[model samples]
Target: MDVLIVGAGPTGLTLGIDLARRGVEALVVERAGELFPGSRGKGIQPRTQEVFDDLGVLDAVLAASGPYPHRMIWKEGERLGEEPLFEAAAPDEGAPYTEPRMIPQWRTQEILYARLVELGGRVAFGRGVTGLTQDADGVCVEFADGTTVRARYVVAADGGRSVVRRALGVGMTGEAVDPAPFVVADVRVRGLDRNHWHAFPQDDGSALALCPLAGTDEFQLAARLPQGAAPDLSLDGVRKLVAAYSHLGAEDVTQMRWASDFRPRAALADRFRAGRVFLAGDAAHVHSPAGGQGLNTSVQDAYNLGWKLGAVLRDGARQTLLGTYEEERRANAGAMLELSTGVHRGAVRRGGATVQLGLGYRESSLSVETRTAPDGLRAGDRAPDGTVAGVRLFDAFRGPHWTLLGAATAPAAGIRALPSAPGSYGPGVFLVRPDGYVGWAGETADGLGAYLARVGL
Candidate 1:
């Protein structure tokens, strides 16, 4: 295999789909027997929705998800007023999706896994990694069941306690984002209507929230436990928790599908790559779940690495292209870590920056701008949605290929060209990377070939 992705979470599965569509030989291995059965990472930010759009899972996600509802505060069994649960900028056509969608993390994975299979990808479940070794040529991965797989590159998406990251001797440095223990569960309840995210704030500085899960009869129960108290993850224990936090009786909680407990913390790996191996998702960074940044950031990590891996393996690009993955993602992950920690501590709001649309690789080594004083978006900015010559920008840039908007009129070699530039992009030929960021820009096609050659076009 060209690549071995350990951990079949959103990150690994997404990388699998991207690599599969690019015709790269990659395999995803998961230690878990089945997909995760929790609704922990439920909020899908707008930028991630754009990623899902290109990956062809946006429609499924939208169908299964609903808009975030207002939070209904409760005190002494009496309903207080309502407040916004999630912060979002005012709606605009800056992109197809401006607001985040509410879908269970499990459903998102299922949709991604389905798309991966549709693209002829394969995932091996119950293949736990016991150990591994790497060389200049490739990486040798050992599994718990006395089996080994070798690939040119390996991605560690197995999550925060990643065995692959440990084997590579990578250290994660972090501090607790919140001192209180937290418990999240998915349960079926009878007393709560599926309209508002019901919240019961306690005077003791702890809180409980039960939000109706989109496209399902379940509710996601998240509670901020008192400091230093251990959480009980049992179904009965969850029922008792509901009774203690709300007006609903313990018997009102009918069924518990899944549950987990954790202490919120923010951590980042010392590095994203070591030799032929790379760390992605929680393996590379772990953060507070306050602003729903953890899973979204993880998915973007895979998106950033997917096309680069394709360029190297399928298109014969230089190995140096792979090095940029660590350079770009490590910095972005660090920034997101700070943002998540801020949100956890009430230092930041859940809107604006939390959406992640403003993020780009402005300082990346690959983002070269030959044009002087280019108007509108600069090199390495996200190519926003627009239309030119009756052609939608996103539609033109959809597939596993680079798109050139502006100056160059004709498609050349492997690059897709749209000569008529949208007025918003200023006046230059912008080469959009497969991951949707403008990699190179120029007043004309000058130096375009040089940039392409550098990226192994």
Candidate 2:
């Protein structure tokens, strides 16, 4: 096989879909028997929404999810007031979606799996890896089921506690964002209205909330417990938890769907790439669930690597193109980790940085700026959406191909070339990478061919 992905979560599946559509033979394997059933990692940032749009799952995501609801604060049984759950962002011509959308992790995986399968991608479940070794040619992964799979490259998307990461002796350094234990669960409760999240803040520094899950009848119940406390995920324990926090009685709690306990922590892998195996998503970095950066950052990690991998394996690009994956994503992941820790500590507000639309790779080696006096857009910035020469930039950039926002005056590369660029993109010749970042910019298409050669076209 060309590639072997070591998990079937959003990161692995998104990479699977991208590689599949690019005609790269890749396999996504999962140790679990089924998709994750929890409503964890629910917030879909605006940047990730754009990724889903390009991946053809945005419409279904919009169909299955809704905007975050206002929070309804309560004390003793009385309603205090209502406030926005996150900082508000307005839609602009460049960005159509600004606010975060709510969708359970389970639903997101289901949608991604469907898209991967539609692209003829295959995922083998119940395949747990025992260890893996890489040679110059490929990586041979040994599974606990007494089987081995070899691929040109292997990706560790198994999770933060990645078996692949550990097997390779890669060290992860992190700190506990909060010393207190936290419980996150999805349950069916009768007393809470589904319109607003009900928050009950106690004086002892402990807190509890029941936020209704959008497009579903269940509400996600979250609470902070004392240090070293074992989280009780049982139906009876949840019933007691809600009753103790708010005015609701234990009888109001009906069913317990899915539950997990976590100590909010921030960790980063020592390195993202070790030989032929690359670490992505939770395997590379772990973030506090605040500001919803963990999942969004992870998904983008896959998006960034998927294209580079496709270029090397399918488009005959140099293998050196793969090195930029770690160069770009590791720094971005480190920044997001700090943002998440700040949000977890209430030092930062949600909405702007949390939306993840402003992130880019301006400092990457792949970015080239030939213009001495660049205007609004530059190399390594995210290509904004707008109409250029009667062409929609996002629509033109919605596939596994590069885009050229300049005059197609002569025999140019096979990239999709627009006659002109939108005002938002400035009046510069631009070469948009397959992952939607401006790779090269100049006053004219002077060094476009040289840059394309590095992209392995």
Candidate 3:
């Protein structure tokens, strides 16, 4: 195989979809016998929505999700007040999705898996990667069942406790964002309105939140335990905890679908790439669920690495192009780690920064900013969506090809050129990368040819 993704979570499945669409030979291997059945990492950021748009899964995702509801604060069976959990922002031409959408991580994974299969990709479950060894040319992965698979490259998307990352001896440096334990579960409940996320704050500095998960009949119950307290994962335990934290009785919780617990933490892998082996998603970075950055950042990591891998393995681009993936994504992941930590500590609110639309690769080696006086959008900035010459900019950038926007006339080269949408992008040639960032920008195509040649366009 060209690529072997070692987990079937959002990261691996998304990478599989991207590779499949690019006609790259890739396989996704899952240790579990089935897809994850939890509602962890439930918030989908606006930037990730754009990614789904490109991968052709946005409609399904939208159908399976709903907008984040206002948080309803309660105390002693009395409704205190309703507050917006996230700061609201209006959608503009530049950014289409201005608010976070609520969809369980499992549903998102299913959507990506379906899209991958639609693109002729395959995922093998019950095949856990025990270890991996890489040479100058490729990687050999050994499974727990004594089976082996070889691939030109391997990605470790096996999550925070990733066995692949352990085999690679990559160290993750991090600290606990919260010392208190947290328990989250999907449960069928009563005595709560489905329109708001119900939160009950305790005087002991602990809290409980029961959020109505959109597009499903279940509500996600989250509770912060006291220091040194063990999380109860049983259905009876969930019921008791609900009674202890809120006004509802233990009988109010009808059923518990799934449950897991963890202390909030923020960690990043020392390196994303180790020779032919690469780490993506939770394997590379683990974040506090605050601000909903973990899964969004993970999915974007797959997006950033996917096209570059496709360029090298499928399009015959130089192998050196792959190095930029680590250089670009590591820094972004670090920033997101800090942001998530802040949100966990209640130092930052969920708003524009949490949206992730402002993220880009301005300082990367691949970002070629030819124009010294560029104004609005520059190299390493995300290409915005807008109508240009009766064609949407995102529509032009949907496929696995580079796009040249704001050009009055098409360059002699085979690059896609869209009429200048001066209102949104200003007047300049914006070379949008396949991953939706501007790789090069200039007054015209004066230096576009060199940039294209460098990226194998």
Candidate 4:
């Protein structure tokens, strides 16, 4: 295998699909016999959707989830409140997705897994990594079945307690926001309003956030139990929590589909790579699931690293390209950690979606330095989406890429023109990456030269 991915979760599967699409041979090893079927994270950001578009999996995901409306958040179990978290007004009309869709984590895994298989990569389930040894040449991975495989690179997309990360002796240090454990239940609650999220504030210093599952009247509710509260994983517990929180005297809420317990912890590995072993997804960072950004961030990490690795392996680019994976993604993960932490804290203080997704990495090597004001947004930063761009294409749906909008013809190279007005967005700028990421931005004539000179492009 050219690359061995330790886990087949969203990040690993996504990376596998991306690598396969780019003609890179990769293998995904998962411990479970099949994908976990449940809702973990609900909201997929516009930026991440752009990556899916680039990988040609967006349509599949959309097909799997048909006609799901944007999630609506509520306070105290009521609907008609202030604007929802994703429905708030932004400067750009098309900046965010026309509608932010919701899908369970397991379904997301299935979609990615199917795509990976289609791309000539397959997942070896019931195989878990137990040992790993890496050197300058390659890495030797040992599965629990006493099987060994050699690969040039290894990515640990496993969850927080990653065996590959532990074998590499990478120390993950961070604080646990909630010392006590909380219960996460994904059940189909009947008699609940089809619209609006329901929250019940407990007197014992705990609360719940209910999110609706599209097309189904049932809702997915996340509630924090009292510290050290160990409720049995039964229908009784689900019914008890719903009634206790909502305090609805007369509603028959049954059908407990799935239930699990999760401890909220915040941690980030000191480094993302060691020799041939690379850490990604939860293996690299874990934080509270406040903004539903964990899986998306991990997938984005894979997205960022996949292309760079392909460039290095196929194009013989500098090995230093791999170094930027940690530099760029580590910083992005740190920002996500901070944002999630704030949102978690705000949940305890004031109940609402306080976390905003506006992280920008303008200071990265991948971004070209321009004359934009320091405080203003930059090319590498998360590009703002709006209607001013004249087309929904630049509206932040496809993630920020090299967008050159203007009338004047500037010499540009290594750029992909978008399906929008030529040079209307920026005359000289010719192209933007799928992520709305500007690979090289400037006049087509002199812009490519100036960009190539800056980053040796």
Candidate 5:
């Protein structure tokens, strides 16, 4: 195989889909027997929605998700007030997805996995990677069953307690954003209206929140535990916690589907790559659940890496293209870590920054800006969605190819060019990369050939 991805979570599955569509020989291996069955990582930011759009899973995701509802505060069974959980923004020409959508993490993974299968990708479940050895040619991965597979490159998306990261001797350094442990569970509960997220704060410092999950009859229950208190994962324990924290009786919670306990922490790996192996998602960076940055950041990590890997393994690109995956994504992951920690500590709001629309790779080595007097969008910025020459910009840029916008002359073979729309893109020829970022910009296509050659376009 050209590439081996460990952990079939959103990160690995997303990479699988991207590589499959690019015709790269790749395989995804999961340690668990099946997909995760929890409501963890429930918020999908706008930037991630765009990524899903490119990966061809946006419709399914949108169908399964719903807009975030206002949080309804409750005091002793009496309604206090309601407030929006996220700052609202209207859609504009630059950004069509102005707000985040709420969907269970499991549903998101299912959609990605289905898309991967549709693209002729394969995933081996219950096959956990035990260790790996790398050479100049490829990486040799050993599984728990004593079987081994060799691939040109390996990606570690096995999550925070990643065995692949440990085998590579990578260390994660971070601090606990919140010292108190919390329990999150998916349960079917009665006596609660499904229109809003119900939040109940106890006299003690702990709080409980029950949010109605969209497109399902379940509710995600989250509660902060008392100091040094052990979390109960059983149905009885969930009922007790609900009764202790909220006005509803223990019997109100009818069914408990899944539950887990965790402490909110922020951590990033020392490095994202070691030889032929690369770290992604929770393996590279772990974020607090606050601000809904963890899963979104993880998905984007796979998106950043998938195309580079495909270019090197299938499109004859130089190995240097793979190096930028670490350089660009490590910095973005670090920024998201800080944002998640800040939101956890009440130092930041869950608004624009949390949406992740402003993230870009302007400082990356791959970004080439030739215009001396740049005005509007520059190289390395996200190519905004709009209509140019009667064709939607995103529609023209879709698929595994490069797009040149506003070019006076026709671009080289294999590059699609759209007539200049100075009002939207300013007076420059923009080379939009496969991942939807402007990789090169110039007054004309003078430096276009060289830039495309660098990336094997």
Candidate 6:
């Protein structure tokens, strides 16, 4: 195998699909027999969708999920505010990408898995990485079953408490700034008839939130549990939690689909890549699930690392580019850490933005020069989206496309001569990597020359 990925979650499978599509033989191993069946990450950011577009899997995601438009805030049964979760304003078809869709985590994994299989790759289930040792040539990964496979690179997409991270002697820093127990129940609640979220602040104890799942009548009921009041998660216990936090009485709460107890925590690995072994997804960073960024961040991490790894395998680029993986993504991880902490503090102290909207990159080489603001030059930030100008072939439905963005008014040659049709990565001047991070961000036709030179394109 060119690359061996530990943990077949969204991140690992996505990396597999990207590598397989690039004709890189990548192997994915998971401890679980199949994709996780849970109501994990429910929101997908627009930038993430662009990555899917690059992988040629965005349409399946849109079909599997539905657009999630509104995100609302509440405190103790009072609706504090509601706003468009993606763009601050309405999204036009010309926009780079619109609001993200909401889909269960399992379904998202299923799509990636299918794509991976289509690319002549398959996940090795019930296989866990027990030990790994890397030398200059490659890495030898030992499975729990006492089997070993050697690959040029090994990636740990395994969740926090990653076996590869531990084997590599990497340390994670940060703690659960605000420790609280919360119950997440993903079940069919009968006849609840509630369309909006209900938040109840408990000054005496933990808070509670009822977020309505889009495209489904079932509601995701989340509530802070008293130190010892956390339920055992039996059907009756799930019913009790729903009854207490929700207006629906105990009599009204009858059925439960699934439920689990989770604690909020945040941490980051001291290093993201070491030698031929690398860490990504929750393996590299872990944070509270409050902002709905856990899986999205992980998937994005894979997107950032996948192309770089493939580049190294094919062209053997400078090791510095591989080192930059940690520099770039760890910086994003640090931002997500702060975002997660902000949400936690808001939950604990009250009053802060709980929803993560367009959290752009900072201090990257790609950012364009612009006047500094309270936040750094968000200019040259994630390229803002708009309708494809002067093209009838632009298809908004087949998104996750690389948009060749420049001043439409700026004089550049052959902009019209570029591919004027939709592609797997969508119709754009050219496709960037699967990750939203731009490999080529050109403000003019000649600007592409500068970007290509930098990346040795």
Whole-model Cα lDDT of every candidate shown, in order: 0.91, 0.91, 0.91, 0.69, 0.92, 0.67
Q: Which ten residues in a row have the lowest lDDT in candidate 5?
A: 406-415
- Model 2 poorest 10 in a row by lDDT: 406-415
Candidate 6 achieves a global lDDT of 0.67
Quote model 2's TM-score: 0.98
Minimum summed lDDT over a 10-residue window in model 6 is located at 409-418
Q: Model 1 over residues 121-174: C-alpha lDDT tens digits?
A: 989999999889999999999999999999999999999999999999999999
Compose the digit string of candidate 3's lDDT tens values, residues 226-247: 9989888999999999999999
**Candidate 3 wrong stretches, greater than 4 Å:** 408-414
Candidate 1 backbone clash number: 0
- In model 5, what lDDT does residue 198 have? 96
Q: Say what the RMSD of model 1 is.
A: 1.1
Models 1 onward score TM values of: 0.98, 0.98, 0.98, 0.83, 0.98, 0.80
- How far residue 447's Cα lies from its native spot in candidate 5, in Å, is 1.5
Off by over 4 Å in 5: 408-410
What's the distance in Å from true for residue 28, model 6? 1.0
Candidate 6 per-residue C-alpha lDDT over 406-441 given as tens digits, one digit per residue, 9 for 90 to 100: 333322221222232222223233323324433443
